[model samples]
Target chain A: MPRVVVDVVLKPEISDPQGQAVLGALGRLGHRGVTGVRQGKHFVLDVEGTPDEAELREIAENLLANPVIEDVELHLSGD
Target chain B: MRIGVVTFPGSLDDVDAARAVRLAGGEVVPLWHADAELPAVDAVVLPGGFSYGDYLRAGAIAARQPLMRAVVDRAHAGMPVLGICNGFQVLCEAGLLPGALTRNSHLHFRNRDQALRVERADTAWTSSYAQGQTITVPVKNGEGRYVAADADLDRIEGEGRVVVRYAGGNPNGSSRDIAGVTSADGRVVGLMPHPEHAVEELTGPSVDGLGFFTSVLQGALSA
Candidate 1:
């Protein structure tokens, strides 16, 4: 089996309000070790037999994530 | 002249866009997002709404719609196109416009009458307004902050591509207080404000928004 994983995260230059809010909550809970947090999306795809990394990359860039404000990382594995 | 207004599943302002066209003395032609062929019209308007329920990202799915392909084709040929709110996001996602609209900086759904300064009035969609004119219109959205590369923003500012800039205060953390912008050719425009909602004074704060529709209508009819 072939599988591909995609991770989408906001660009570092852009502000992440959700992550900030989470950080504030964590502070209230006394989590002192964590300095910062960022929220992102993760996707896993099972391509059955052989998977084309180029095609999966295209889909992730075009539909799964917006490159203007996000960065995508693709990981492939075989089992 | 006839103007086409596109409607996606979650489109909330197609009726208001159509009404503005009528008020501007232009016949309205309804265009469905799923439809491949656009009706015979002088121009197209992508009204504001949560198209595809803003899935994955705002305007991401709707930008790939069949109707958008047709609109893009016409826009490239110099046909005027106006996109408001979510429609603006679609334009960016479709590559008809630059930059992207993301969540508001404060992460709140904002609805208010906002003041905007018309930066340029030479485009097909803003020929009726004078340069440096100020107008008030409704601005409402959950994710409307605009973002782009610094070089791109600088280039746009240098080329006079910015159409409108927010006045009084930065409403949504848009880069350089930009509220609207036009394509390099001045045919395609996208803005995150609801000008259609302000076309009628009784329904909105002011009727200043009518100029956008009238400008395009007159331009098309005269051409």
Candidate 2:
């Protein structure tokens, strides 16, 4: 099995609306001092069979990350 | 044509998306977030809804789902994929599309019939319409703001990747008023509006959204 690790990150300086809303709700609930929050996701895939890394990279590039706003880091585990 | 609509646990628009696909004359295959197969569908739709209950982030949790792996594979093979609303969030989160869907400038959840100009109708999912065509579709979301750096924004605009722009008003303060965009090859599209809800006249603000589904079907058949 080939393991693929994906790290998703938001662009710096982009305001996270969901994070802001949570911060506001937390403040209203009397929990202050939350400075800043940005949210993203990570995925680890263990493919059952070996696939071409170039093809997989194409997948990551086209369907995994939007090149305009998000950055994607791809790592292949277990050669 | 067989179109797959993925349903994450918290997804609210999968059924509607399937219905739209069926109405557009394609067989609908319901896909689950945990699945690893794409069900042999010619195209896929990552439907709207608060996937993973908007945990961590709006589309962040759902973006890591197992089915997304298969979607990534098929989409790379040039399978047509469309992301709507929260699905759009997942696309960005999954790194399929560019730009993040943040909160509205007014910081409110907005639900309204929005007018959008089809800026580029050459994409696989939008070729049925003409460029500069104005269509009304329902837009509903809290995190709908779209932003990118000036350079990337210029490149996206200059490369003709922008598919739709808010026509009447800047609903969510999206940079360049962009509401939707297509991939470089035009096979994958991500948009913030709820087009599935507008596929039928009786159930929607306009039947204009039928073109999106039909366009994909037509494109697939022609290809």
Candidate 3:
């Protein structure tokens, strides 16, 4: 069996308020040395056989991330 | 004139949109998300709601529905389409319109009476409004911030595709204070404000929103 992992994140220019909020909370909790923070989505997919790279890329591009404001990266691993 | 209002599983404003059409002297036709066939209607309105539970992304799931494919084809063929709130998200996701609606910068679910200035009046859904006319409508959303690449924004702005802009203050931090926009042919329009919710003075802040519904009906009359 194989697994595909997709990580989706907003473009660098796009602001991530959720990440900012988390950063603020970290500061309040006395955690230091953090320059900045950003948040995103991670999706894990399981397959019965070898995953087709093109199909996984298509799914990540069209469904997991919108190209307008977000970028996606896909990784495959075997169980 | 006959107008169709699409009702997705989580749609909350379809009834109000249909009522606005009837009040504007047009017939109302209910369209469902699963149905690919659209009835004989002069125009279509995609009302607001959290369709598909806003899963994966706002309007992303609903944008791929069977009916939206037909709507996209019709929109390209010059049929008038008005997308409000979530519907606006759907239009962007479906590629019927440009840009994408993202999470609000302020991180709040804002609901209020918003003021907007009509930027273009020749569009099918804005013909009733005068250029520069200011109107108030209800805007309620959690993810309504409009964003696009710099080049795309410049292109759309250069083409005068912007239909309306925020008048008093920026509500959701949309780029250039844009409240709404239209397709190149000016037939397909999408906005964050709830025009259908503001069509009746008795229930809404004012009757200013009626013009959106009436504008299409008037266009049908002349076409």
**Per-candidate interface DockQ score:** 0.68, 0.28, 0.71
What is the C-alpha local distance difference test score of each model?
0.91, 0.84, 0.91
Off by over 4 Å in 1: none
Tell me which of candidates 1 and 3 scores higher on TM-score: 3
TM-score of chain A of 2: 0.63
Decide which is better by DockQ, 1 or 3: 3
Rank ordering of all candidates by TM-score, starting from the highest = 3, 1, 2
TM-score of each: 0.96, 0.78, 0.97
Report the CA-based lDDT of candidate 1 relative to the real structure: 0.91
Cα error, residue A24 of model 1, in Å, equals 1.8
List, residue by residue over B60-84, the lDDT tens digit for candidate 3. 9899999999999889999999999
Q: How would you encode candidate 1's per-residue C-alpha lDDT over A36-77 as one tens digit per residue?
A: 999998898888767888888899998888888889888877
Counting clashing residue pairs in each candidate, in order, gives 0, 10, 0
Give the DockQ-based CAPRI class for model 2: acceptable
Query: Which TM-score value belongs to model 3?
Result: 0.97
- lDDT winner, 1 or 2: 1
- How would you encode candidate 2's per-residue C-alpha lDDT over A1-79 as one tens digit per residue? 6788877666775656667777788889888788766666677777767857887778676555555566777788732
Second chain alone, TM-score for each candidate: 0.98, 0.97, 0.98
Q: What is the Cα-based lDDT of residue B116 in candidate 3?
A: 94
Which CAPRI level is candidate 3? medium
lDDT of 2 by residue, B1-223 (tens): 8888999988899999999999999999888899876678888899999987786567877887889978977788899999999888887787777767776877878899999999888898998899999999999988788888888788889989899999889888888899998888889899999889998879999999999999998998787
